[model samples]
Target: MNSSNHSIWFYAVATVLSVALGFFVASHYSTSEPVYHHAQLLPQPRALPEMALVDQQGKSIGNNLWRNRWSLVFFGFTSCPDICPLELQKLASLLRLADASAKLQVVFISVDPERDTSARLREYVNFFHPDIVALSGSNTELANTANFFGAAYDRSVIIESKLFSVPAGIDMPVNAGNAYQVNHSARVFIVNPQGAYAGSFMPPFDAPQLWGDIKQLIKQ
Candidate 1:
């Protein structure tokens, strides 16, 4: 095979191995202690920027919301097909395994504000777990807040003239934007108990290691 074909074959093999390993880890990963794989901690925790985001209760929240408890913040729209709900469930499992003595919470920020109104967001997040607080706001507000965590997303509108609208939380891609897709960050940004931007946990997330590290971080 030529060099170009060799490179493609190498990547294809790597991709297949990765998918197989992910399945193996997922199937056998039981609730137990584990060593963290790729946890990145910042040199210093950064204060969140002020953004007028509304909580699940439809109350306005400022940056102060990050102050009281350690938060596992993930930026994803409710309509996300697979990763979003799986990530939140992993965070929820972390809470279940984590030391309950310390205060910890999950924050789900919607990137699709046009469809994820406060009411829509609340309903979507509540399906996972009640303690998981969902937040949504104006596009600018979301952008500002997301920037603070180095998170970014973009909506790819279908170029075709066909039009359709789907409710939030539906997995179907053919939506009101004429079959568009909103891609957002998958990293779960971690905040300290004092609500400072501590670090992040990248996927493929291992609940045991993540919660264990979070429990330790909350103590710091």
Candidate 2:
């Protein structure tokens, strides 16, 4: 072949090889990484930010609370009209469906610190599941913790009829003047046993799928 022809052929061959290699790497990755039906895994685990908060028992704790066990961290408030109760119920179902050997913990962080005292959090969470850990703190502390987990909340929104909006036959014990709503993120964060932000599960969770994903991560 002429010099120019040879150069073109060489470039073409290199392009083909590059494309093939890309496909090979992608295929290998797709097969090697655990297929999660629900959870969205992060590209890499992230260290959790420092936080100073109070637990349900009025005990002072921090990010270290997530260490030593896999945690499904959720952010909400005790007075939330809908999402909080639904998610907690889902977590309760997950705990029931999970294997006894599963080293899993559910952490509920209240964003409405002014209303959701440690005592109130304790009662609210325990009503759903006894094992759930409820945490509350000052606005600064709660904001820092929520931001670290990519959660967001806004307390400025007010709904005068929020108290009356609860479904009939459902008793939601709200503190006096708790007629406002705090909009918050609905995502549930996943923390590794080492207390690192690992991944997250979006809302509308399916207990079976969530359990499957957690089981897979537990084995890893």
Measured on C-alpha atoms, candidate 1 has an lDDT of 0.78
Score residue 134 of candidate 1 by CA lDDT.
92
- How high is each candidate's TM-score? 0.74, 0.77
Worst 10 residues of 2 by lDDT: 163-172
What does candidate 2 score on TM? 0.77
Q: State in Å the error of residue 218, model 2.
A: 1.6
lDDT of 1 at 130: 79
Best by lDDT: 2
Which residue pairs in candidate 2 collide?
Answer: none
For residues 1-220, what per-residue lDDT tens digits would candidate 2 score against the true structure? 9999999999999999999999999998766787888789888999987778899999999767877889999999898889999999999899989877787889998887777888899899989999999998877777778877779777543245443332211223444355666778999999998989999999776788899899889867
Tens-place lDDT digits, model 1, residues 120-196: 88888778787898998877777778888989777765445754443333334544453467777899998776667
Q: Find the candidate with the highest TM-score and give its number.
A: 2
